[model samples]
Target chain A: MGLAVILCLITWFVLVNSRKMAPLPVSPTSAMVLVPPPTLTPLPTPTIYVSPTPTQRPGLPPASGGIQVGGYVQITGTSGAGLRLRSGAGLEFDPKFLGMDSEVFEVKEGPVEANGITWWYLVAPYDESRSGWAASNYLQIVTTQP
Target chain B: MDIRPAEITANRANSIVTIQWNDGHRSAYPFGLLRAACPCASCRGGHENMSAEPDAEVFSTVLPESPATRIRSVEAAGSYAIIIEWEDGHHYGIYNWHYLRALCPCEECRSRFGEAV
Candidate 1:
């Protein structure tokens, strides 16, 4: 009976001590949690620009010479010196204005023989105020009116 | 006042026709103005429509560059009037001294004669 009481008491003390022990410490690699990176907003697409191309008129011959009444002409062959526009066909008439090189003008009246030169009356398109007679030497026909 | 032109000169270089009056006053008329104010019976639309003064519309009218507006010659009619021949071959306008004075576009004349004349 004394031997049985001793063994029972020892077992009870061991159970109490086992219950008081702390849990095991966690490892750093095993404790890590997988998280996704934050979602990003995308940038707008860039706009592309293209240059304009000149289109050729079909069946129309390129203008070279022969300015007619109601036709359009451009000042050329002046060596950038510009052409003189006079109030009258003759050189005796005062200069109305200086027509710049490559400037376009519409033929209003023309072919007046004066000062041994053929003169054509030219007027600015859409503006009759700027009109005068110009010699044919510097004028290139741009287009003839039908 | 009897206003008579002492001298009439067409400054084609400036496109202005100037008339020097006996009273020491000068009137400069634009080539366009004279063409627009052509006093010919046909230009006035009819003989009955003709008047001593320029029509009210002539002052404000802007005639385009044409043979009708191009002065070929200006001739005296007797001693009181003058005739202007346009390059277009229209020469019936007989501009008298009284009518020409009234047609002056100067500020002073416009104020004195009024724009309607």
Candidate 2:
């Protein structure tokens, strides 16, 4: 019986020492607690830019002409018919419209010249009752047509 | 009272666009006061109420700086307003007939009121 007790004590001693000598089994909870080292990521940079080329567009060329009328003066013939000469374009006077026998003023069908100034003229008959040029500044050229 | 030609020139430059008058005077005007006094739908009221006053802030903001807008050319629209072209290539402002006619700076508006008064 004494030998058996000594053997049991020796076995306990061996078991305790063997536990200290062998590697400890890691716990599941403890294993999960380990933290990994942080990873480094590169950030993207923004770039600024300017345009080096000019944009092109298609269209008609700009207008490059200049023409304007100066002034107007009423013309009277000596016949006492009270006829007034008027310009439809402000550049020429109406010579054919100077008398009562003339027809309604129509711009002379073609370019006409008077008093050394060249322009397109018109001819209209003078109504004896209407004493002066009906309208002086009403005449103007339409410039945008061509 | 004495008449200052510089003042006349300045006032004439300030207002009185398209100086075509019955007495045979012709000149181009600026967009400053004219823009302020625009009688169109946007500036003035509309066609129905032609006499409504324009907003003061709009007028103050729109006055062109001096040296004033250089008039490239002027074209007549009937017996009333004129279409004007500016040196800056803006050709949209069409001045009305009554406005141009009323800008006569003779003894009437000048001596009676003040310049552009």
**How does each model score on TM-score?**
0.44, 0.26
Full-model lDDT for every candidate: 0.68, 0.34
lDDT of 2 at A14: 94
Model 1 sits at an interface RMSD, in angstroms, of 26.3
> Best by TM-score, which number?
1
Candidate 2's interface RMSD, please?
23.7
Q: Which pairs in model 1 have colliding backbones?
A: none
lDDT of 1 by residue, A18-65 (tens): 999988978778867878988966432212111121132111224545
lDDT of 1 at B50: 91
What DockQ does each prediction reach against the true complex?
Answer: 0.01, 0.03
- Model 1 RMSD in angstroms: 32.1
